[model samples]
Target: MATYLDTPGRVCRSLSEEDMELVHALQINGRASFREIADVLGISDQTAARRWARLRSAGKLRVLGLTDPIRLGNSVWLVRVRCTPDAASSLGKAMARRPDTTWVNLDSGGTEISCSVRTRSPGPEESPLLQKLPRTPQVVDLSAHCSLHVFFGHDLGPINKRGPLTAAQVAALTPPDTPDRATDATPPVPLDDSDRQLLDLLARDGRAATGDLAAATGLSPSTVRRRITELRSAGALYFDVEYHPDILQQSFRAALWLEIDPSRLAEAGSALAAHPEVAYATATTGTANLYASIDVATAQLFYRYLTESVATLPGLRHTATAPIQRTLKGPGPYLPTTA
Candidate 1:
């Protein structure tokens, strides 16, 4: 029997082991060289290059260097905007184009748009694009949830037990700890024009070569490299890879919104984070204090996990579940990735 990495949100249907191995390598170090990945996976550099080309051309994968909004002098907010059906498409697209939003999607049959935005200040008035909208008749309602803490995010990019890399192979690709990965949190630092350009390019493709970055930013290769290191150490740059859940045979997906006693927020977060089915979980401000995105093999499996697994957690007050209708934009820099 052979395995396949299903391409959801696209026409493709199957992916080979080599294809997944290539993805796994990039996930560990998005900017790794084809030759380095080839050496670790026991394939030729040419083979690794060919596999990457195939996956990327099919739109089954994307490797991006995403910056933490908090590290960029911004606050992260989860915003849900409800619009009339006639206005939803245009409104969703308009929201997606803004520089601050990520993971934008049309849920609840296209009448509701869910997205996370980065604001320069703490209040809703400080949101770069969303604040401009008036509560006109066309816009039915809007709610904003400020993300207070992130327990699991970019650090776990689609992790699964079925990953293609072996323990030894993964060990070979892991990079040594840098100051940026330290426990101490640092305040957001300002960026000049050149730094922004570099991040914009990396956001599109973190594996872009030095020469490519130099040309794009009009800086020498050495200068580009130096700036990248500095920004990284300052906790400004991190990389993540995106893939649809269907690829792993975990097709059922839903987002859980829960209200928990404030005193036990950490206990609830840590408990939820321990579940393999939980993809992304966080503590936020809004009607629900905790939000989680989870994927499972089927509805039965999801129900079992919820009743048997999630029900056991302490301080869990209320819960709500919304099936992700279609991902209009997956997580990444402000780019829109639609199904």
Candidate 2:
């Protein structure tokens, strides 16, 4: 069954200020209610709710709740699969359906499929594709980079319009950063069935109504709300808002592979995340210990960032760059109108 987000022939339009404001608000706090968002933006709750419904119906926006696999004591790895031309489409789609893979895409050439996969540990069936690919006739080559430290990914991307939300407005929308909440450095926790169900619903729409969730899960609205709060406090889930990069004039996109000293790895990753050009970055276990995604205005600007900015970082041993020809799947489902 096809969904509106993946349906064909959808119209792609640019977002207005109202739309942009709502998008930014969600980026700040994905679970904020229409009333809370309205309070911050000085609009009616109905208006905020209607606008969001329109955006989702038009396939212009996506809100996702994703678990940090690495923090969960799972192995996160970036994989590049080289397959025959005929097998590319089928192989990529097959990998995307797996619960383990995220950000799956067919790179510049259709023959190569690039994606990141997470696993609790190494086993024959830990990553079905990784193990099976080596023996499969169509898969010619495979490269896997184990993510050691993640500076940024998913929800950590920079917001398009930062100036629209005043400091007070942002503070109003944001949840209090309690001591129990997990940070990048914090360890992981175990999740129960209810937690998984909440995550599954939020993965489809982070702003889903508590009443709707209650209906689906056979739980009271209050129980659903309390569960969400508990999960958030445990740092078991975080929300990601997906939007078109071209809207912000970042047309050129590139993938970076870097090698750094093990001792300074976390420090280096943190520094890379501070740069606006870096949409994603991580420290992996491979020849190239670090990997990053860059979105810039022009090719020249990317070159300058690589030479001038990236060069200044300490313990940087080697670097490699690859351009992302196309994105088959991003944070959430690949939306044709939005992408």
Candidate 3:
């Protein structure tokens, strides 16, 4: 087992260099063949497969196929809720169990919860962020921001930058870049029931064998492969590798809400997105129009980032930091704990 100190004045173990390399390879391409990963890492294919199995069985990593909300004509809302001290845990758990919520986390000393909500349409009635969350008596305050433009954190994740893979190794594992469909004018391809079923299975395990998927979905292996290609080409689905941050020796995480001059919003957002510490950055609608999630090794490093990386942004007006105390859900569907 690997670990890292969540707070100062504590020490914890972490993944070995070889394991970290394996993780980085998957982050580049979650569905890469074991032989491909082995070739890049200079290890045997059997070793690569064994390592991945061990990691997966331990719940230390997951490869998930995620849908693009924007491509599906949906809106993503970043919601922050302030709750009474005693109610935060239960509230966080409840939010995590919702299908529309991701990145559900406890923050601001466990008094505030932050999560992202995806809605199929643009109305208060259709959005849990607007309709259901504010109704809770234990919730003291709630704010939701509509994401306008994402500067980064979709195609690639923070691990790609922080992991130990060399440039050549990363390039070896990375698939060739294709034109982004999210910005194109093409209407999204509609998904049939079979498509949905395949997606659901992939959401649980992106690298599931084609035969298994065929058996589960009653589609032939060739059909499963073809559908995956079509969905990926249409930009309706993509893959993400999830793991504990401790594997990378990054224990501290925080969300940033920043107010920037309107004229400089695009420039600042792009600039912040390029920073190594930032995992996600987007422009949104609210008092603080820019939002980012950052991970680092320690509080001192975080301070240095604030001063060296963020302080110099042009037209910076105000900034607020909410430390993430725990994450209840990530990029994939939330699975409730079984009794």
Candidate 4:
């Protein structure tokens, strides 16, 4: 459980080391049983459950189910919108409310908005970027970068690879990899109405009990379990954990866009992905072929990382950085509690 200071500001303290270990355990396997987690963490099951409840009630953490766009034959785009200074907040909130948008953020002194949009195949007239945004009067300019390849993010989120977990503990808690049934040569696994309903419920609470999921989806427990397994095995579903960044003592966040030599794109992307400061990295289309989300403890530390780590990347031709002022939406479903 977390503690709060009794100072004039009544500031909340950061999570304790044990609490972070519990968080890291869930990152390893979000659906793991409390008893299982306790066993690995060397704590009692009741204590583990109580700590999780406290953290969740405090809105410090969440577990969510996310889908893979490529596995589902969909596309993802990173859109940057330059709007009127006064309209930036409204436009950002509107975009955050859209089910298709995630990672909605306000940057560049509250005059620009950035978001990731997931879209199924749509005609030009139906495309949000191609048709809808251009018609908005308040939007001064817009650029949508189609993701060509993801070097990090999704199931390989920063916490999944780096956290409080020791090598032995991580290995003990890590679940076996689900088989990859989603291949380019194979057609995407089709989702039925039931599948959609299940996904919606899990998106809100990935660790929802099997019985609760069965009751909500109007299916037997066995059937619900089987379907979840099938979806995960097909690479169509995955669990992601979200927590307050302060737990990791990170206070600065920034978005980076870089234009790299085409021949060295993969090399540059991989190097950026491996850096501890980066939360997400991908190769995209447009003037800046590579984009990344960075997190650090301070602005000075960020500058150090930029000069020491990022500046040394191979074939880096041009670079642009925008400090993220606020995040309206995260990787999971939109929730007002999300920072």
Q: TM-score winner among the candidates?
A: 4
Model 2 vs. true fold: TM: 0.86
Q: lDDT score of model 4?
A: 0.81
Q: Lowest summed-lDDT stretch of 10 residues in model 2?
A: 1-10
Candidate 1 per-residue lDDT over residues 100-139, each given as its tens digit: 7777767777788788888888777876466665555668
lDDT of 4 by residue, 1-339 (tens): 111111121223577888878888887778889999999999999999999999988867888887888888887889999999999989888888788888888899889999888878622334565468878999999888888788887766666566778899988987775555344565667999999999999988989999999999899999998998888878888877776544545667789999999999989999998998888998998989999998887999999998999899999999999998877778777776422
Error of 4 at 112 (Å): 0.3
Model 3 TM-score, all chains together: 0.91
For model 1, the superposed segments whose C-alpha errors exceed 4 Å read 1-14, 160-162, 177-185, 244-248, 333-339
Q: lDDT for each of the candidates?
A: 0.74, 0.73, 0.82, 0.81
Q: Is candidate 1 or candidate 4 better by lDDT?
A: 4
Q: After superposition, how far is residue 123 of candidate 4 from its true place, in Å?
A: 7.5
lDDT, candidate 2, 192-284, per-residue tens? 787678778877778788999998888899999888776676666777786543344455667788888888888889898888788788877
**Candidate 1 vs candidate 2, TM-score winner:** 1
* TM-score to native of every candidate shown: 0.88, 0.86, 0.91, 0.92
Model 3: residues >4 Å from true position, as ranges? 1-12, 177-181, 184-186, 336-339
